[model samples]
Target: MTATTVDMEVRGPWSLATGRAFWEGFAPAALPAARGDDLTTVLLVEADWSRAEASVAQDGGTAAITVDGDGDLDAAAAQVARFLALDVDATFWPAVGERDPVIAEVQAGLPGLRPCGFHSPYEAAAWAVLSQRIRIPQAATLRSQLTDRHGDRGAFPAPAVLRGLELDLPGRKAEYLRAVADAALDGLLDGLALRSVPPEEAIRLVQQVKGIGPFAAELVVVRGANAPDAVPHHERRLDDEITARYGDGATVDSVSAAWRPFRTWAAVHLRAAREGRLHEFG
Candidate 1:
């Protein structure tokens, strides 16, 4: 089939370089791997339950998306936008840094860094199930095995594909994963639907799925839906960074007030800096 291509205008400061950096190192096992100049991954077009392979690259003020699949190309494009956070209109993101020197410092180090997220909430919830009570590397192995055995190309299996599977897994993870798949099939985990609601509400909705706790729910809403302004109430790393930069008395609520609509961006920058994922973290 001929590949469908689209060029989407980016609303704020963006750099493909920063995005590639995040894709390559941040949760390599859970997210798409950045290859060469393009970030390629298979997207499940929820509209019709078909798979599309998509390649995304930066083109001036736009993101150029090339997709190869039989599914809905328009849906594929929209999902790509959300995954890369291109859907966010962050034209005013820089002003947040200007108001806070701490944010300003990280912004200088990691310019045009947007919060990249899971392809969809379904995938993130599956990850939440696979990663429970286990180290990331181990969970990554399990995910790879599942994808290699059941996924098309490198795409994670669709919910319909995942729900019927029965296999050996630690504890009741397989059961929980099936539950997650059920939620996806029911449209409870639809990315657009989840993104339309408040992050707190989204978290509440996701937590209704079995084996998903507050922390996991946060991942589904904040990272999965890619909410720009959602405050991560449970991220210990952000709390540590907050105290490190703003003294021992500083807290997520106290300092995050200044972050306003770009709280997620600020928090991601701080975490990236701490993990030395950016070129210059100082």
Candidate 2:
């Protein structure tokens, strides 16, 4: 089988290292080791999955994608584009950053930050369910267990592989995983179609799947589609986040209103702040 290559033009500030760090920082074992200048991962294109590699050009305006398989190259390129969020225009992010001191600071520090999506919406949706009620490390552990039991070498378990496993996860979580796998197999939760929808509708559509609630659905939109407006409602650490954003008394709704289309980025900033790792980007 011949390998396919594509030079994809992308808008906005993008750093391969930044995107890779955003992915593996919290969960190093999610898929495989995404390291170095090229972030490589497995992606399914049409009916086949391949190891997809994406790297930034010297100009920082293009990503060269190489898929090592006979899979549909066009589909693979599109998938890489979605995963790297190449379509997001950060031109206005600086201006948006000016509205709030904290965001302004975060934006300045993380110069080429781009929100990284999962390999597919189905994977993100299933991941939300699997991680619910567990700490990040525990969730990563379970994910590792599942993949180790059923995944291909250095790849997440394929949908077909997941369809037969009755893991000892919580009943709803296990059922949700299987249901999402079936959805992925049936093409209902393909990344392209879902990524094209409004965040609200995407949340509504994914909620139709079993065991997906409002929080989980919205998380999918944020992670799966890179919906900028999605806020993780009910998230703790708001006071510290509030102080970090707008000094002592600012509320989430009041201050976040200024962030409009980039609220998802704000959420990540807040999380990083709470964990005391804002200096990583700063």
Candidate 3:
């Protein structure tokens, strides 16, 4: 089988926040590789051998993507193009009104905020389950380890591959992985199948996993399945960021109230803030 690779740039009136959000959620690692230090408004694709890498440099106003695999290059490029097109639409824009002062401030400073969604429910669920109640860096580390240990070496693991893997980690980490593995084996953690189910059912299905709770389950629904209105409760990092920014008065309802229909956007902004992209919002 022959493999093909292609590179393309997505162009438009661009926003850094939107670009980062889309790339981070969809093609996390590739964004850095393709764009380097340039702000990407375009998507770059390199595809071969049934695998692909996508890159975006928001500062350069372009995204670089690569696809490789035993498949049609055009089809892979189309998929990359679809993801890039979504970022340019209002679907990814965070709705902000003048009513709330803080949101108004955020909007006034950074007018390009947008609403973005995830493409893979299974990956989202797995990420959410692994991220529960941990620091972002720590969670990322654990996820890397999980992928390295139980997942396929070059590509992400299939859900079936994770089903019965014996995960060895130190102490509590090991316990958590085993629990997730058990859920996968028992068919209780079917994120791909649950995508077709209603949000409520999907939440129920994911929560049946040992370590997954309402918070993690809801996050999977929102961040994984792209259920736009799914609100995440019990997210400690979110709460902490609110407190640090707005002080003790940053109650969940208070901090998130202004976001209304665009709470997910707010969540993404908080995440960006953590990543030292606070200037991106402005």
User: Total clashing residue pairs per candidate?
Assistant: 0, 0, 44
Residue-level lDDT tens digits of model 3 in 1-282:
343444444343346555554455433222322434433322112122133433334434444444444455565555444433432334323344444555555544444644333334444555665555565566667666665665444444555556556665444544555565555555554433554577667888788766677877776566654543345676776677778777887766776766655566566556555444442211
lDDT against true structure, model 1: 0.83
Question: What TM-score would you give candidate 3 relative to the actual structure?
Answer: 0.61
C-alpha lDDT of residue 273 in model 1:
83
Quote each prediction's TM-score.
0.94, 0.84, 0.61
Which of 1 and 2 is the better model by lDDT?
1
Q: What lDDT does each candidate get?
A: 0.83, 0.67, 0.51
lDDT of 1 by residue, 95-154 (tens): 999899999999999888898858788888988889888987788889889988998777
In the range 1-282, model 2's lDDT, one tens digit per residue, is 566677867666667766666665646233345445677776545345544443334246877777665556667676767666776666666666788777878766666777675666766777787888877677777877876677765456878878788788865788889888887788767666666777678778888878778877876677776666666665666456776657767677777777877787777666655554643321
Pairs that clash in candidate 1: none
- Which one wins on lDDT? 1
Which parts of model 2 are misplaced by more than 4 Å? 28-36, 45-58, 237-240, 276-282
TM accuracy, model 1: 0.94
- Pick the winner on lDDT between candidates 2 and 3: 2
Q: Which stretches of candidate 1 lie over 4 Å from their true place?
A: 28-35, 277-282
